[model samples]
Target chain A: MFPLSPILSPKGQGGGLRILTHVLALSPLAVLAWDFARGDLGANPIREVQFRTGKYTLVLLVLTLSCTPLSMLPGLKWVARFRRSLGLYAFAYAGLHFLNFIGLDYGFNLRLLREDIFEKRYAFVGLAAFLSLLPLAVTSGSGWARRLGKKREQLHRLIYLAAILTIVHFAWQDKAKTVEPLVYGGVVAGLLLVRVVGWVRRAARGTGSQTSSKEP
Target chain B: MDKIRSSEITPEHIYLGRRQFLVGAGALTASLVFLGGCRRLSELAPTPEADFCGSATAGATSDELGDPLSACDAATHYNNFYEFSLEKDDVAELARGFKTSPWTVQVGGLVNKPKTFDVDDLRRNFPPEERVYRMRCVEAWSVVVPWLGFPLAKLLKEVEPTSKAKYVRFESLHDPKQMPGQKDRSFQWPYIEGLRLDEAMHDLTLLATGMYGKPMPPQNGAPIRLVVPWKYGFKNIKSIVKIDLVEEMPTSLWTAFAPQEYGFYANVNPDVSHPRWSQSSERRLGERARRETIPFNGYAEKVARLYEGMDLRTSY
Candidate 1:
């Protein structure tokens, strides 16, 4: 008889692995917090901290979304378990990035802040990206998931739109089309294409199932 | 699962993790130490006094006066864009090799006396005076600079401009071997600048030989440069070699490159906007926020009289 065991059973083999994964995922956040506390954020610390946090947030968000495709592989069941924590970390960084911009860049000047958001195209894109991420971040925890019910999946799908806006925010700010933004855009385009293919297959299956049931 | 547990608990794994942590912490510590050192280094570079180079005597005051803080700050910070090793700070280093004593100013065109005046002779002929004025750049930045030199009008008096001389064209030193910018054909060099007869004679306009109570740093247009307040920074040409009284307007470096962007007059005006950015606001050196730029950079009281009954919009 084969050993009758769940691959990721919480009580057995996966418990230590789960703790290690959490530590690895949370380390960046801890380092960033330490950096802020020490005031070792580099010259022009406000800009430096905001840029780094925003960049890392986007990377983590992309990585969280990538878990779904990775988990589809036979040997990669553990990848799905890390997605929730990765997403929470992304939200944490994004919030910090937004707060830094408001406090440092605007100095809480409401009138100037409003003007910047409305008058400047780059600011508008950034604001849009922030707004898109807000709902997703709010709905990330299990409590919110339970309350959202059917709407939970819809809210999470907004991450795709947020990711696109993030890319635009970066690209538009760059006067020259340098390699950094281009690489981000390429990765995002590839990820979006994977979703598109999945959606098409699902739609095709639905149509085929309907025809077979009618014939039977 | 058993194999994975052994791998996780291995001595190599623990050692590697500890080593990585130490390295990361060490790198962070080193950077912090370096930054602290930099702050100390910056402090060591002597701070300028509030009234640096200002007149010490209460009674003796020059007509050309400016805010002293702005003047000293500008004298140090803002500089001519000499892209070569003779950059603003390093000019003293590179300039020691060059011979500035044998320099000559070629006076030709509509001047009655079309002759080469040795720099020493010119210096002796016109006694140098000190003038402090606000210098504003087209890039929407400004500084108050105290210039030590004589008026161009005084120099013009000696040359004796002919009746045909309507415009005064000034050219900068042109040696590709010396000035690397001269090698580029994109800009016509020796950099030429022109001023109308009345404008050149204006009391505010000075041919500066030195700044900050010392001989002009080689980077700050050593020997001589034109200082025209109420005009954009570029109008103040550097390291002049020739002064020609001409009939037509001489081609200016900035204006020639982009006529729409830079006009012949190049007078500082808040109304005239640069294509890329607004000219209405300017970042005064050491100021927190940008301030509204004034017409003729606040020299309208003196310079506006010269442009009486003339359209500034056309000239600008």
Candidate 2:
């Protein structure tokens, strides 16, 4: 049982929800900026920023994935409409996380960055995840999706791979405290399982109907 | 990596009292704002002499090193005392009210003169001396701390290790009730660490009692801890209660947990990378730029000779 608030309803004002989404998405960045200015980012500010941005990126991606499952409920198809915006926000945070690593931490030191990419498992997987999100973000517009047709769906399915890589990146980066990353991995696995189960049920039903028609 | 902030000393007890008062009032939200303001204000305010140790000498050795000492707030609050908590930032809060008094360190095993000295007696006898050193964490972060203590060599000499002793094993106090982190069975309790007898006798290896010219905070290994400047931070075991001079190499908590990742000799070597991450460079506390990690953490001239002819790559 879920709350039937206006935001969850099909008849809700799209403009209000869009504004709420943007405000919610931008608030973390604003808080980080404020903390940076006030010198409240603790001992290692660059690290604090990297951790926050990376965490939010995974969180937003999880929310974006959940939209598909939520939309299957009666009168909750409106949730699907927010998927693009949520996904783009996740992509934006991922970009910030990458920038923090390169610009702030590395000071655009190309050699060091290159070495990390090659030598470190976490760095390689993180870069791969971000690269996978890049194409999805670029072609997120409705125009490109329409032009590409079913191919667009196939391309966007890379989110699953991106999600898995992102979790691995996070889990590996932590020296200790595995629980937080493990929780994220579990959620992603559960969301993907829902989609797989739904697809399997539909395929079974379709085959059953085809066999029945052939018999008639 | 050493710099003295003699003028910047803020006693831990006074600060803890202030924090407790704010918490008592249930003004945690207001306290956050207060702390933010105090960060700027504390710098301008001159602090009084610490009451912990009378005639506590200032940092003469570290003043010439030139590397700015990390903020006392950061050095104390950000700790890897897994006995308290796994989270570095959370250790301070979690270790509050941890009893460090009435502490006795048992020095025995292969020592000719096995002795169990009360911590206070040891402190008084050795006298707190300031030795600021660069502490490089295995996680690739570092801090320069003005630790107040005498060398481990002095203590070991007093006990007089026998010819049979090859390695020195150190153990921390293990009370699961006081240290809630010990309740988690995933981690080994009563944190254990070891050093080769020679390494333990190195002049830089300190039996630290305090830092920033005050008594050590409970979070930062109150009463006493180890400070091995050349080795990674984990090797510098905290809140130590037992020191046994043994023949065999002791299995340290980290080494036992992941032997491949954390080797017995966790010396700071730029060439030797951790299994998961590079140790080539490290981010110093409060600085954005990364500094190249040198062999033996820049104490190579003094310590490189200790590891002569040994292949660092394989050993690491």
Candidate 3:
């Protein structure tokens, strides 16, 4: 049998890191729950919650993308371990964001939801990002990883597309080119550039090794 | 199915029954608390005065105008898009720090009398009278606020503008240390707004310093703000610093940023829609209630004459 324990096994000694990640992930939800209980949702609670969750989702998604680049730094080797959890947290927030939009904003009216997805450019981008993540989330389990074999990594590449769509959704929704969206766009670009450069270097190394072995 | 059958009742049903009981108890407790809170608040709140400004002469009545509750509700919620804070609620909170005392307004540009008048001096000279009017915001929300202020025409008359002056431009306060939004370059600081000479001189147009009962809340533009009933809320610039009687059409913040989205006139016409969103309907403050927007925010009879022979669609 192929050795799968390294990827599947939970970190035995570094359990504190896992706990910290869980705490950070739950902090937003806890605040939301408290706000709801206190009835401090403000004038437009639906819009407020939707905007907050969406912004955090984008922030966490950017953080997830930054993990590899961050891990490259000598002091930040542990950052790579949190990448999967961060991505999952981002997906969870994105799910809540979509649910809030549908439940509170649209009241689960399928027709209005369909119309928004089709007619509104920002809605279309948001819907695309949500849909792109669905497959990645479903295939996240190790069972599915084993079933998909080599294709698991290829399917996960859709995250880059989802991030781009999310940033576009934010940009289009903003009436003015404000600082928030511009900063998000810049960070996302930097993260994607790092990924692209890393991929190219890996491909070049593989090609060089194959040619050298073939010549011998 | 037969194998699963048992003589004892399932624990799931018992758990569900307990859950239902707890939910019922919780709801009852909530209502009791809510009622008690409401009673406490009502006790604390000052009784609604018959006349907010005591300036209402004989024959001036609340019913003669309309419902006061509706007017008060409209005044508070629908506001200009002054994103001074990350959260919308922050506007009211942050504005409390603003110092409105010893405020002065500068009047210049093509006007014969170019001078700065203290806010108290302006108030003492002008002497505000209450005017009940509808306020419509570009965001498709509106309210009928009872504004207490002097007429804009009265102020304009004091500062005699030359015949060449066809437009009047208003600038808002621009100190970034105070107005945090000014620190960012998203919009030009000292937010500029303007009106045509005729519109500025209309008797209905007001330079408001107070609303509801007391002096204007800082967030609602304490000291002074314009109230052009016919136009959208943004046209009514707040915390005004300078008033320039100009000859040319001044570049408004909203118009300069997105001309297609916000027009120069920005009249509150239900027929003329914003480029991004529909303006046909408006949500009145409180729970899920909405009303159709009216032409000139239902003041068409009084103000529509000004826009006669002009296309509202194009102007909007």
Q: Write the per-residue lDDT of candidate 2 for residues A1-216, one digit (tens) a residue.
A: 113335555564454445556767777777778778977676788988888889878888887888787677665666677789889999999999999999999888888788888788899999999999999999999899789876887788899899999999998888774697899899999999988887777667777565322100
Across residues B1-316, which tens digit of lDDT does each residue of candidate 1 receive? 5457765665965654554454345334533432331222233344332233343222213324434435443454346544233123333334434446688888888987778888777778886766667788875667766577888898898779999899999988877787664665656566778999889999889998777666565666778889998999889998889999999988887787678778889889877656433466665665535567789988899889888897777779
Query: In model 3 chain A, which range of ten residues has the least summed lDDT?
Result: A1-10
Clashing pairs in 2: none
Error of 2 at B53 (Å): 16
Query: Model 2: per-residue lDDT, tens digit, B108-167?
Result: 999889999899998999998888899999888999888999899999999999999999
- TM-score list, all predictions: 0.57, 0.85, 0.74
Reference contacts preserved by each model = 0.00, 0.42, 0.02
Writing each residue's lDDT as its tens digit, candidate 3 over B1-316 gives 5576565656865754454454345334533432331222232333233233343231223422463334442244334436365344556546656888879999999989988989999889989888777676776555556678998888888889998999999998887887777776767777889999999999889999988756776777877999998788889999888999999998899888888778889988877755433366565544343456777877778888888899888878
List the candidate 2 regions with Cα displacement exceeding 4 Å: A1-12, A204-216, B1-65
Query: DockQ winner among the candidates?
Result: 2
**Candidates' lDDT values, in order?**
0.68, 0.81, 0.72
Residue B150 of model 3: what lDDT? 92
Q: In model 2, how well does chain A match by TM-score?
A: 0.88
Candidates 1 and 2, the one with greater lDDT: 2
